[model samples]
Target: MEVATRYARQVAVIGVHSPKFSAERDPANLAAALERHDVAYPVVADPDLTLWNQYAIRAWPTLVAVDARGRVVARHEGEIALPDLLESLRPLRGPDGFVAGDAPEDASGDEPALANTLRYPAGILADAARDLLVIADTGHHRLVVASLDGQIRFTLGDGVPGLVDGTGDRVRFRWPRGMAMLPDGRLAVADTGNHALRLIDLGAHTTETVAGTGEQARHRMSGPGAARETPMASPWAVAWFAGELWVAAAGTHQLLALDLEKGTLRPAAGSGAEGLHDGPLAEAAFAQPSGLAVAGGRLYVAEAESSAIRQVDPATGRVRRLVGRGLFDWGDRDGVGDTVRLQHPLGLAADPDDARPILSIADTYNGRIKRLESETRTVARVFGGGDREQGEMGDEDGVGTAARLRSPAALAVAGDRVFVTDTDNGVVRVGDLATGRMNVLRLEP
Candidate 1:
């Protein structure tokens, strides 16, 4: 985004989306994703992978730089640092190099204000004990705290994207994602876009930076370092387990651990490689792990890129795959173990009310909420699902498979109800776990 803004006059950025999942091929879903991410540039949806085949693209994100005359100039696979990218483009700045144009007009000013509505909420947590619902209003760059009945309690951040630690509205966050409550009642946040971890004290209305250097890590592998000194790479989700905070470092394709007592950060699992290999912590690989939950005395990960669920043994640092086949195997199918298929699931929560370990999943691409029984190894749809042709797969309240959702990113189970961040729809949805009935949660101040 910074690159596009910085070189707007000299560069014309166009996004070509080659979807890996069928649901992503839907024009509505694609449009919703663009808006949710605040993508200003025009995007071409290559649902048939025409562009992928023509360009021989082998990765999810392959940047192909085309010159003003339409000749391919350079190409890069995977993430690149902004500074490096800017430096590489320096040669194409002068006359006869690249064309310049006026900046695009901002169309957002014409849109009506949606003060009470969430803008692309990405993560949610329901504290049954406290009767509180916490939401990561990702696009708005704020965290909202509300009562279970939809009454506003308090909030964190000032609706701006940055890295600042202070009290209430004085604090700032950038596209915060998953959250976990500390044993002492403080809220731990994966300040994703800021590449940092933050702590929120609800009673004090204060926020503190616990880890990260407020900059994205350029390197793939990161070692133990002082919490505030460590440069993190897109810490997407966080979970508290065994006296440590576990982080799903999505950009690095690894799991990280933060020791609150020692105030240190270290890699916990994955070797910074992007794949579906599982074994010892150092040798194990992950594909954009985006969600974390603790269940059955183990940590479960939502591996988004592979559309898989994984289990990690905290005692031995051993990783194992629970569901999904590989990077290409994805769908909206339910069964047991490896027979089940998920489409880029991103949210996971352990059911606190169940005696046996049961996981609630926000199957993002499938637009559904699912349940996984740890003991039986059975997967079942809990809510969501509808007809795509009829446009029923988005922003509709119903029961069971009749309910509609668009890219539900995160969910939390609170006793008899489940709270979901219907991300692309920009709303928080609440569902009755027993009845499968779902409705949009209207927040009120």
Candidate 2:
């Protein structure tokens, strides 16, 4: 993200993707990942590790800077600090050091059908009473309001990317994610890309910033005094429970809570470290928790980087890992406890109709929907493939696993039906929780 912003024209960023898994080799899958990340540069897919061997790269993320004449100038392994990167490029920015080059053709294939409908929708929310559906249209940098029957009601953000507060077309957002409805009929938004929280007043038709300083948080700031003044780092998803808004702050690797009634924000879980350390809230660690579901005083976190499911007890301030083994231990396997594996699961939703508590997972990288019974502690695939099927075309309105979902991201439960943001397909899919039949909901305009 920094490189894309700081060196858009000064440097030509070429992503050499050397895949560790076979599923990452597919062009469509790679394209979806790049698009989800808002990457505009051309990326080379090196599935056979051809580039790895050529570069003699043994580490996962190795940065090598080549001069204008194609001579290797600097090499850094692992995460490089932005300041250090800038210093390394300082000497190479002279007139004789770098030169402008012709722009390369965009290799991202044909435009998806119904590009106007949605582009990589990330967050899904439903109000059964109002028959309303809210989607965080991530790729489009907008919010889409529609009926469960696929009728467009109102659109927010004006389909533009920026941080602006207003109403209707005047309001703007950059890759906004997760949304939670407050008790007073207001919507709290995790404006992920903008590093802020936004509030939408539907009745008044106005939008306002409730949290963050409209900038990314570089340092940790705790307590109520720092909450509104401090910048936030990628608030990915939010949930409202007990008069407080819970946020999955993905970029910061922690959970935050905004007291809606008091209008104060503070960290709720995680210690801003990336790992699986289950313990008290302040000491517990999480690896990029992208989705959250709160129920019965427990917060369910979908840790994307670790491919793990963890639970947090608000009253006790304790966190425990329920599923997934480790960061590198993820595949298309299912079972009980740590034996169950999920690949980069993102969004989670609780089954409202179930007598016993149940959670649905968007096992994103594996392209499947999974279910876990909170009481029995059993995991099973409810839809899509248990194994990765990269090139297979999705069967819309198909029954059971026959109905393929391309990169399902966020889920919203409305009675016995669940709405899935099929990110890769750029459409919303509704699934019957009882029968496991999924059909695409067509949106006009």
Candidate 3:
């Protein structure tokens, strides 16, 4: 987002995408991901890790500044403040610095079209009682509200990627990712690209920024920053449990919580370190925790980069890893306890009707939907399987064998059906909780 915002400032921004998963190496998938993120800058796919190895980069997101003579000036590993970065580039913009190109500074093109069909939808919220389904049409930069039977109703955002607050169509969101319904009839949104949390008042039909200062936080913070004052770094998913809204701050490698009643934001788990460690909330560590779900009294987090599922007890401030071994150990092997394996899972959904806890995981890199039994601590692939292969839309539908999925990013359960955002294919899939049969859902304009 910062790169896109600063593209017109006479500074060159190059996006070097070095994918960790084999599925992401494909040119089509890489293009889809870049488009989904709304990266308007020039980007190159480092499939063979050539660029990464050349630059000696180790982190998933690394920034490097270079002079016109091709000498490295600055390099930062994780998230950083854009204002500070822009300030540092001012000196280079002068006559004695890097030469300006002949191309236009505002390289970003016009906004894309708005349609009922989704493109790279990442998050889903299912209201069973009201029979309403809300999808985060991320690539299109809008939220699609439709009935369970597929009737398009309310559409949030004007389909333009931006950060504007208003009611209904007037409101804008930049790559909104996750959503959680609040007890007060409002929806808490992880407005990811904008680095902020937005609240959607269902009754008032208005949207407002409640958390984050609209800038990504550069460093780790404890509890000093208030709700609207503090900045957030790539908040991926959110869940409402107990009395607060829990956020999976992926870029910061930690879990943050918002005191709904008090309207304050604080770090709830992890110490901003990227690794797999389990202990107290403040002492524990996480690696890109992306998806969050609440079951019973504990919060289940899907650690994306580590391919792990973790359990967090808010009352006792205890954090423990339920599955996955480490950051590098990832595969499709399934077993009990430490033997279980998952490959870069991004979304989780707990079964609300079951007394025994059960979570559905979107194992993205493996192109499968897995089921995790909380009591037994066992992991199994319930649907979809293959080595970085996305099957056809209905190829595995109604077959007793493993169901096929194409980079499923998010899941939502309503009664016996599990709704999935098949991101790579740009469609929604419904899987039966009882039989594991899958089907594609189409939304008409």
Candidate 4:
């Protein structure tokens, strides 16, 4: 996109994620391709056009014009012409909008333009919104929260060493590993240390334990002696889907689906706690299930020892392998003779705006993120692989960050931003989902 077209504002562009596009679609290359020689303003590199499909765009460059009510007023598509671009941008230009090309409604929506900054530099990964970014500073044994502009919103769970109802409130997270958003706008933390699900009420500014009052795992049952029935065995990842909370009970080697509203738990895709199969629940199991992400009524799980990404059909306990050749097989590629396999994969998420429910896998050992199109089970390489240093796709060294991202462990995507829990360096790196540029949401430069 020409910098002039979306100058001083934000806009997202969509396209099919073809090898041809990823190869030639580098941001630096975009300016040259567009004949600007140089350009600014992020051009959301949506290879799958996830946003396009969901937002109902007929073609590329379908600009969704939002109103103050956060509703899309107009949509422009197909190599937007100058006149069409101007027309699509009219509402955001006047005094009513926040920035250039920003819709009138989005102007005052929930996201804050300025990001809050903190002193934690070792941020390994971050998950957040325009208003909030959760940093998983692993080395520090704590999770950090900041505003959209990188402002230090607050660092949470800095105290205690237990997992239970009384371990700690929002202020204390015991080595929290991952973060997720609740339906009510509250924040959920995989208080890893305590082996529990922690909740943070954004409105109340208070923290509480929503699940696993005790630091242990068990099956979910109802009634009478059912108090401790809903247990998670070393639960590592958490996801909100279909109005329920799902946990990867690594300790038990099973996926525990919880009805957060009713406080009920049940064996979801796997019956028993250990095994990998489409057979009955008990026959199916996992080897240290870690990352958990939900989209389009399906759940994705990252099996560490097994080295496979398992897809779970929520309604029926059906399971299938999305990636990897076999259990404990570490290769460079897949199907090409045991090569290109995931090494110690951890975090996982689905591209919301995409039609394929693409699974973004943080191949931890590979230091890269792999986008797996669930529909076809094909994989595309994104930020990561052999060079874990810093930059858009810099997790090449068995660590997630190229430079700013020291070790990305978790994934969170809200609105137009993508966050990673850069645990090693102890800081969360927030970037624009479209441009993939390092976005610091703080008051400081």
Top candidate, metric lDDT: 1
Comparing 2 and 3 on lDDT, the stronger one: 3
Better of 1 and 2 by TM-score: 1
The whole-model lDDT of each prediction reads: 0.86, 0.79, 0.81, 0.55
Q: Per-residue lDDT for 1-445 in model 2, tens only?
A: 5565455677777889998645677787888788777686678889899988988897657887887899878777754456666667765686664443554442222243243478889998988998888888888788888888878778887666788999886788888889888888999899997889999987676889888887777654455545567678889999886568888988778888887666778888888877888999899989889998866567788998888989887677799888887777888777888778888889998866435778999988777888987666688887776234332335455776777888788998888888999988888888897887888888865
Which runs in model 4 stand beyond 4 Å of their true positions? Answer: 1-130, 138-141, 163-170, 218-231, 280-282, 334-340, 386-407, 415-417, 430-445
Sequence-dependent TM-score of model 2:
0.87
Model 3 TM-score, 2 decimals? 0.90
Q: Tens digit of lDDT per residue, candidate 1, span 35-80?
A: 8777887889899999999988998788888777877777878887
TM-score of each model, paired residue for residue: 0.93, 0.87, 0.90, 0.61
Global Cα lDDT for candidate 2: 0.79
Best by TM-score: 1
lDDT for each residue of candidate 4 in 1-445, tens digit (9 for 90 to 100): 3324544344443333221223234453333333321123345555565765677665322456676677777766433444556667676566653344532221111332222222222222333333565665433345556565565655554333334333223265555666677767877766665667777765556677766655454343222223234445566777886677777766666766667667666655555434455555445667678888777787788887566788777577567777766554653353321244666577787776555587777665454555677777776555544342312433222222333333356666666555655433333555454654543333333
Worst 10 residues of 2 by lDDT: 106-115
Which of the two, 3 or 4, has more TM-score? 3
- lDDT digits (tens) for residues 1-445 of candidate 3: 5444535555777899898866677787677777666577799878899999999998867888787899877777776676666556664567664443344332221455555677788999887887888899887777888887667788888777678899997888878888988877788899998888999976677889888988888887677458988988999999997688889999889898888668789998899999999999999999999999888778999998889999998778789899988998887777898998888899999988547889989888777888899878998776666433332222345432256666789998888888888887778888877776878877866
Ranking by TM-score: 1, 3, 2, 4
Give the clash count for model 3: 1
